[model samples]
Target: MYKLKTKETDNSVIEFIEQVEQPKKREDAYRLLDIFAETTGFEAAMWGPSIIGFGKYHYKYDSGHEGDAPLVGFSPRKAKISLYFATGDTEREHLLEKFGKHTTGKSCVYINKVADIDEEVLKELIKQSVLFLQERYPGK
Candidate 1:
């Protein structure tokens, strides 16, 4: 059995943000917190040690692997901020075309700073991720 490490915990999101070493990243974390919360309509919660996540869904893979995860989340990392969104959504890719300056991984988008990306596109990503997960998982 594979173990998942990024489970939601009772950790404080504010405390985590305050502990961010870089002042600029700390400020961007605050801004992103507000954006994700407002856009997703879900309260922020700590996902493991770093990610500030909103909403949640449980996914079971074809290999029988399953776990609960946030619908949308972001982390202010030492290198850059990582934006988590739904994978396999075509619309997500389309939106990213206009997402300002950012790089994408399988499911995580990396941005240097909040100011480097368009706020409106960020909101759209949050919205699309939440919707995609809700539709895919359907009330998990």
Candidate 2:
């Protein structure tokens, strides 16, 4: 596997976000930065190339695949915003229903526009996802 260039929790990610072209996207990114900072109790920093991540967790699997990654984070991709929760939450389906226009993947929640969703509800979603991961993975 190619090695992750930035050492998992570096400020490089933050710098990358401030440089996004779209004004709305930049504002949305900062909003996420504030929310994640408060919720995860870890300072918001960049993870990898373009992800705004909160906290850090080193994980090891029975198969010996072990490494460190952000506990909670999101990336503003070209198509949409991708948020990583690190665990599967069945109840998240309920939130997404009222979350306006959005999509869900295996362990991520995606939103096209921040205007299409409730900011408060979105914060709760992040909180719940982080808690679920904490319960499953135990500490970062």
lDDT of 2 by residue, 28-87 (tens): 887888888887788877776677877777667787766777778888887788887756
Q: Could you tell me how far off, in angstroms, the CA of residue 126 lies in candidate 2 after the best superposition? A: 1.3
The digit string of per-residue lDDT tens for model 1 on 52-108 reads 999999998999999999999999999999999999999999999999999988779
lDDT of 2: 0.76
Instruction: Give the worst 10-residue stretch by lDDT in candidate 1.
Output: 131-140
Instruction: Report each candidate's C-alpha RMSD, comma-separated, in the order given.
Output: 0.7, 2.3
Per-residue error for 98 in candidate 2, Å, reads 2.2
- Model 2, TM vs. native: 0.84
Residue 132, candidate 2: alpha-carbon lDDT? 73
What's the alpha carbon RMSD for model 2? 2.3
